[model samples]
Target chain A: MTAVRPPEADLVVADTAVQPSAPPVPPAATAVRPRARPRPAAPRRILMKGNEAMAEAAIRAGCDAYFGYPITPQAELLEWMARRMPEEGRAFVQAESELGAINMAYGAAAAGARVLVSSSSPGISLMAEAMSYMAGAEVPVVLINVMRGGPGLGSIGPSQADYFQAVKGHGHGDYRTPVLAPSSINEAVELVADAFELAERYRTPVMILVDGILGQAMEPVSASFRMPERRGAEWVLGGADGRPPRVVKSLHLKPEALEQHNLDLQAKFGRIEAREVRWAGERLDDADLVIVAYGTSARVARTAVARAREAGLAVGLFRPITLWPFPTAALADLAARVRGFLVVELSAGQMVEDVRLAVSGRRPVTFRGRMGGMVPTPGEVVDAIRELDGLAAGGSR
Target chain B: MERSVIFAGFGGQGILFAGKVLARAAMDEGLEVFWIPSYGPEMRGGTASSTVIIGDGPIGSPIVDQADAAVVLNPPSHAKYASHVAPGGLLVVNETLVLEPTGRTDITELRIPCTRLARDAGDDSLVSVVALGALVGRLRLVRVESARQAIRDTVGMKRPQVLAADLAAFASGYRVGSRTHGPSPDQEIVRTRVHHRVGVPR
Candidate 1:
């Protein structure tokens, strides 16, 4: 409408500038994904690695496209998709970079296709830019971050350090992507499917944030999934057919207009938070101490809870399945009754802050974490619970 | 019944494959199973290890700090994981590679010449599978037939000879394991539990 050129105009100009000598490189010029031959039939139950389970679950849920780069801990996921997508007649691209993968996902989502992209820690960081753009454009894209330790290319082991990066809006502006963390392979399968459905329901990006340990771990999963109804084609970009042109964009440059966009995003986030907070509470009815954790850490915390209970200690676990919404209300309710909280994580202390905020000075919340790819043992978590149990009745210091 | 088994050796020992076989066998028996391989540098011609947890109920943690049983194929693995085995746990050692004593008085230690047995069985690559057979055969953690089925599942049609070699290696280890030790105490409990829950024969 204004004189400002749309982002797609640059792509059009670049396309026109390309000489015939270089017949436009194939869409996925950089190493197309591997294609898998069709198998005889699906097994009723199969032993699957966590990453492969997530990929298979997404495909079973009728994911229309997959675009991803190779990253540790989640490389198997991309490999699985690369092989299976062609067989399923879905688009698959092994993008040149994490940015390229996310942008491909954005394009597919804008075209009204169910899209998925996966990467590990540093790769997820690289994808934050496109994630921001997709968020602003209100694209329903499902992303999977099989998290490894990192500030930079850290270790290729499990870590929950990306908690803030995932839940606190990694991209610019006040936008939040719903983040789901699954503690087990079966949960990963179910949650990944749910992630796609939720993304479509909210028309916002959703992330299935799992730790590297969960990604590489092989476990048995039934991997049952129901295909979500494809989203209506009203907002899709295609032939105009004499109707008004649909411009899928995120450039709200005007100050008041940007303010309105932010408000709308906030409203959507508010609805998601109110409707979609998912968590699991174990032994909380008479818990003296609660260990707050998610993903792989939550699995360890469950073991720790069992150990503590065996030792006649009143320790329980509060595992938030959805990290973005944070399950603040559930923790708040538990805080009113429990003696204290011990937030155990694989990072130095990412989710601990969320647990603290959830408590809001209502009870003591102690933090214990392992970092740089170190996984916390059940003993460590039990020790932390004991330390939290010893703390005088007061809020987190 | 929950059983945590750690398979440890150098790279190229088929440590992860052995764990996967055990995991598949456990799952086939209707038990929840988890297998986690040591990733990164430790897996590339270094001291590689994997933890497999099999249980009747849902497994809590895939990472096993202390194992209910351990199959140590090399000296470094024996040194690293021997002490981590719980009291009364099974410790299957590959005597061909690990000559030293584990120096632990708390657990059942069965030393097997894995490399020798695997070679006699027709391939050295079956060392881990041999050790796995020893572990499962001695402890009765998983049924031998189910384990063979798992071997079939994991080692499919591509390399049929390798599968045959693995089965032979497993049978040799099972014979040696059965001859060396009586059925483990845990076997009775597992048998009853499996029968009561899944109606599976022990």
Candidate 2:
């Protein structure tokens, strides 16, 4: 260890010294990195982008179909499914519009089949119409959004500006699309599968939130699943024999009927909230400072936690894979054990407010984040964590 | 441990293809692999670069802020990325394509005349393949046999003459790397504990 003795302590030692010469100091130890560690049991190993991995994961989750359009970034995912889906004897629909795509997803869902649709910024804007209809009609579909830099027609970089659009509802209605924000290519797969499971359990639409960078970035994955058994006629649409045709239309003219329909959708949302709220915690059990972050920023936050640990501070990350079904219950659960909660994100303190609301005044929830396309570094997040002791990150700078 | 290598050259020099072959070799050796191309619009026609990450464990970020080793196929590429290579990292440069030399005091730089070697092999098209051979020769990031297999897998049954030239080209490049840098001193020395990633939906 390299030590710098304080001058006061040095004076004390020198003043009291009538001492003999000390033994020779030993050489500094080289950072000892241990030898080969064993591999984890059952590792996933395929090189894929977040969007493609999410699609593959959706397929493995027994999603029988996919519908999409040609868009940069997210196009890789559609291409992947277009090649593989048919070989597995599954339906891969290149719907004309985002609306057409989600409707295909909705039609598949009404028959109790797993289905998905993916699009980028502009295309997702088109999906609002169908998504609202899906929400009102009480159908389950997995919608993947690989967000590009955007407002009207924007650049092709990654951005998280669509958080509100996804959660508050893209489709204008008194309903919500259960949203998931996956952090890595690896998590995109599993979380997308979970979205399918959650959607089915609650009978509502689910969206896998993503961005262009995450869509294009490649990573190794080893996830696998057995090909689902083929379903015959009577399972879904495009069948030879129809016992009774099912209507997927969403029109109720009666005011009472519309109110009842809204009530039913709200009931489903209640069930979703009660049943699903996903979160991940690390170093948090003994942490003096806890940070909440999600999506790609959450991965960076985890890296921050590792660095903070090395700096002799107890810092932890709470990553939400499921953004809504907001995981409020889980946040309430996490709040019971911690003193301070700091929210970090790629957005300007939007989701942090949610974490604060979930904490409900139990503990101070501070937020440190950037807006637009800026990414917070691991070092920057560590400084934020360290400052929590003196409320250095309280409210705002 | 994660190792990153950036392969850079003019677009016509098969820079992206070089990165792909490196990734294929790593995948063949059963290691975690990631290959990413430069995402900006400058990918049009000028100098191009791609980052390749290989590890025994799952790779972290696909975006590399710094690289462990680098192979510069052109002079501009050498100028752009030489400073980014970490100390003790190997830098393989193409003498034929890169005209000027920048010396790194702490890093090892290997010079291979990939284009001349491709000409020597009787084909100039195999220059990148020749560079790939040099990387295998020096880094031994994967085995020569594994790389050859990857070449075979990627090429399939193209022009037999080109196939023969590529094999010779890869072999010559591999010899250069092997003779110069030798095997990585820490070959599998720092082992990474692989974790179960995630399950795919079927």
Candidate 3:
């Protein structure tokens, strides 16, 4: 690893300082254009692995600095940043550890720079304390967790075991992080920009939760993105020239003051929950059963839904793009119409709890999950759906 | 239409690279593609494999339980993946490394001396490329021209000599693959011997 200066000394001016006064920005186009047209003006679609694509997307989204510690599955993202950040004249630091990396990110975000940090399961655990501090201090930072099998040092395979840890809160605080779960590489590329915007909008941490499969899989993605307008924030810890000093901290020793701060945070979270709920549904207009999943499991369940439809089963798919808000209202609406739900995940049962809560016993919410990094094949999931359909046909809900 | 293939070999045999080339070719053809590698503790000299799925519409799962085709470069891989091919699918085996014949008669098996062909093509490290050539040549899943363009795009313009050798190996394997009708006479004989020893009909 290359040595570098400390985080404090390496802080550069925010992205606005380096960018042109008014760079002509293109409109965002997330879909991959077909090659049949062969139009010279059209943006080209390039094949890229998910990790490399997310890194490039972050840079294009005007990320000013990146701090990370290399870990399996997601090490590629750090490696890409290490090479590209320097070329863009941005700060890139391979910190001594996950703790150091998160702190470095906290420092950069404090300086009003668009900051990003990424890791897998265990590394995220190490950064939990700093994440809580950042949330309490209300610093905007983007994090990517390419999840792998875990409890301890589990195998390096794709898993959704961290669903509860991420959306429910990984740190010890009454705080919520906006979590975006993308099912494909193209979506992941698009969500990287959204993560930054959401983090800055709410002045809190935002997470892009994915798994090893998305991190390693290669797919075609559009190479163009709309450049975000960067503006200086009044609360940034830049030297308060000609004014009273500004301090950024999370400590509130006084009991009433701490209670008030917690209440304010809860209000902010409530607003986010009302505004930022995102999800996708397919063939739910006239279906009795809907499969609810996200990330890799959603991808597989999509195929199962298609196969079930072909077999004359009225099966639909509901995928939660934002796992935090959980899309409770939408699911509850479906529960009134649909007979039941089948929640599939790579963990034994994490996201299913949220699905059950959404249904609230109005509909039978069954779960089919695989543990220890093993993903359920589409055939297996289809079989599970078939069995559920049979039970529903027998009025056994 | 959708098709999936598995490329399996030892870690140093460029298994992942081979799958990537096929995936790139499929993408260039405007087909949706997903390439996933088995990233585990298996390092150099250990088992390594990658799965590539191509479809006209959105691809669902990156993992494949039954593939339309498979290319196995070593005996261990053959033992593991030979039966994973769907019926009426194709199996490309590196006969130079995998000596035993796959006894199953359901799928079409093309036994090509991939290592020997790579050696004859001027570099022995091109074994994966050779296997890839045989797969595409026999299956025609992706156009040959698209595969060539994918190679150029992936190998880069900086390395001319390496590109030429890889193209040569691919061409050699393609020639052998297109010429073979079905199971070779030698494989038929081996199958007959095994069946007779086990008191089974051919």
Best by DockQ: 3
Better of 1 and 3 by lDDT: 3
**Candidate 3, A19-127: lDDT as tens digits:** 1112222212233332453355444566788998899889888999999999989988999999889978999999999999999999999999999999999999999
Return whichever of 1 and 3 wins on DockQ: 3
For candidate 1, the docking band is: incorrect
Rank the models by lDDT, top first. Answer: 3, 1, 2
User: Which DockQ values do the candidates obtain, in the order shown?
Assistant: 0.20, 0.11, 0.28
Per-residue lDDT of model 2, residues A204-255, tens digit only: 7889888676787676554443233433423334443636665555798999
What TM value does the first chain of each candidate achieve?
Answer: 0.87, 0.80, 0.89
Error of 1 at A37 (Å): 32
Residue lDDT tens for model 1, A1-397: 1221111111111011111112211111121111232133423456788888788888878899999999898999998888888877889999899988899899989988999999998999998888889899999999999888888999888888998899888788778999988887877877877888899999899999998899999887764554777767688887688999898889988999999999999999999989888887666767778888888887788788888877888877777888888788877877888888888888888888888888998788888888988988888888887777678344433
Quote the B-chain TM-score, candidate 3. Answer: 0.89
lDDT of each: 0.79, 0.69, 0.83
Clashing pairs in 3: none
DockQ category of candidate 3: acceptable
Angstrom error of the Cα, residue A169, model 3: value is: 0.7
